[model samples]
Target: MENGSDIDLLVARRLQALRTRSGMTLNALAERTGLSAPYLSRLEKGERQPSVGTLLQLARVYGVSVGELVEGRPGGDYHLLRAADATAHQGRDGRYTVLSGPRAAVSVMRVELPPGSRSEEARHAGEEWLHVLSGRAGFVLDGEPVVLEEGDAVHFDSGRPHSLANEGDGTVTVLIVSTAAPTPASHPMPPASREATPVTAARRPAARDR
Candidate 1:
């Protein structure tokens, strides 16, 4: 996995690219983000790292989520995914395997939840569809409980508060697809209290190793 410095550099490059693509100069971006032009220059050169707040400001200025700006890639015509080579992102909650390719219009992942595992309630910007692959799972959407067993599926607007838990003894595995791009703001995002960082059972892992 790439280290923090590597990610910083990658984000720096992305920031530069976004600014250039929007035909904005360092001073212009500085004025919009309330940051200094020299600091942005250093950031663009990877000489300095930005805080989360800075990233949010830049994301807002760019009219994209912090995720879209940080993970932005050139659009392409085709892409593919091979299950055999898929990397599983594991965390204290569970693990997930991304099923969508870079160019896929929708995002997808195979989520695994061990017995008793539960996710914190969160909300985002798009709609999500989930199909149970095995075992049983519990979903609380907009404060209503919904249970699903093998061969069951549910689709709901993700902007509503929701949480999940493994309801069976065995592991629960499900396929999740999002109609919109994933964003850091999708969970515990803007206009919501920022006391804690957003986290979902099957979402992207933290930028650093635990």
Candidate 2:
């Protein structure tokens, strides 16, 4: 049974190996993944822990799944994923923990939105389904608001611009299943029309439907 530290080490090694195999330098990877070169270097050298969101970006560039990045291989059955071993990532978005296996076609994530926190608005390919495990959740899809209580769930096209937030004084926990199409890397990242991540770390004001 691997612990959190062990998982982090494994992922670091995998990141280095994958980047090396792809013949990309840290700078090249930074451009491709929209992460800073220094941060990428730290992640490669085990000086920093990677967020699931960052891993997802890297996976997209490499055309692999997050499970592949974490487990370092493609095929396996009967994976015992312990919560202690799972890595949780914090960002301006929510805390995201990827709970699916490498070969799984979909990503299962446990997302926690702090009372004063919310996920960054996202527009992407594929589909999204989420069930509220605890607390209350507020969702805005393409500017329309939807609220969910415990045991509530919703499925929608992920292509619609959307975001989620905690709607109460307590934290909101949701199980999210998402499917993304991988776009393989052929060269350095193209210029982004806009920044993918927010520059200010301050939590955004949670906007609920009036």
Candidate 3:
């Protein structure tokens, strides 16, 4: 069995490599990930193990799977992530923990939202499914308000603008799964005023959806 310290060292080295490749400073990454510079510094030094939420944020930012970041390879089909080894992030309202392998067809996360708190709306490429684990969750999809209680779930296209919030006077926990699609490419064509045909929605999965 791998010890926590060894795992932390592996992740530390990989995190540094990814940051260098992306040309992102510690401060820059901290700002983007909502982590403190000091905390990030300690992580890079192999003094801490990042939370599942932190790993998800980093994977989203770097376009790599958590497996790749932590294992130095696209993990083979079978891999196990123990709860003790899972990465995590705690905020004033709640916490987030990633449960799926990085860069998989589907990414999974456990999210906690505090009462009266809402998440930042993200419009990107892919499809998302969310299951409310506990409490009341308020979802706004393309300007339509949808409320979900415990045991309820919702699925939607990622292109539509969406955000989630906690509706009840308590914390809400949800399991969120995102399936990625490739973004359509833009091409410039020669001027032809003839009636243009509307392009059909194309589906391709890529890493930029987060």
Best by TM-score: 2
- Report the CA-based lDDT of candidate 2 relative to the real structure: 0.69
How far residue 90's Cα lies from its native spot in candidate 3, in Å, is 2.8
TM-score of 2: 0.65
- Candidate 2, residues 66-179: lDDT per residue as tens digits? 677766645677566887777675534566676887753566778788897767666544566878889988887767677777777778766556688898999899888777
Every candidate's CA RMSD:
10.7, 7.0, 10.2
**How well is each residue in 80-128 modelled by candidate 1, as lDDT tens digits?**
5566656554433466655665543366667788889886564544566
How much is the lDDT of residue 159 in candidate 1?
A: 52
Task: Give the local distance difference test score of model 3.
Answer: 0.65
Which 10-residue span in candidate 3 carries the lowest summed lDDT? 181-190
TM-score of 3: 0.58
Pairs in clash, predicted candidate 1: none
TM-score of each: 0.55, 0.65, 0.58
Q: Over the stretch 1-210, how does candidate 3's per-residue lDDT look in tens digits?
A: 666566567778888888888888887876665567898887778876565445545665666665566566455666677888776545323567667664545677788887788876654445678888898788877677777777777787654666788989998998888764222112111132223322222222341132
Per-structure clash totals for the candidates: 0, 0, 11
**Candidate 2 off by > 4 Å:** 1-6, 46-49, 77-97, 120-125, 140-146, 156-162, 187-210
Q: What is the lDDT, from 0 to 100, of the residue 3 in candidate 3?
A: 60
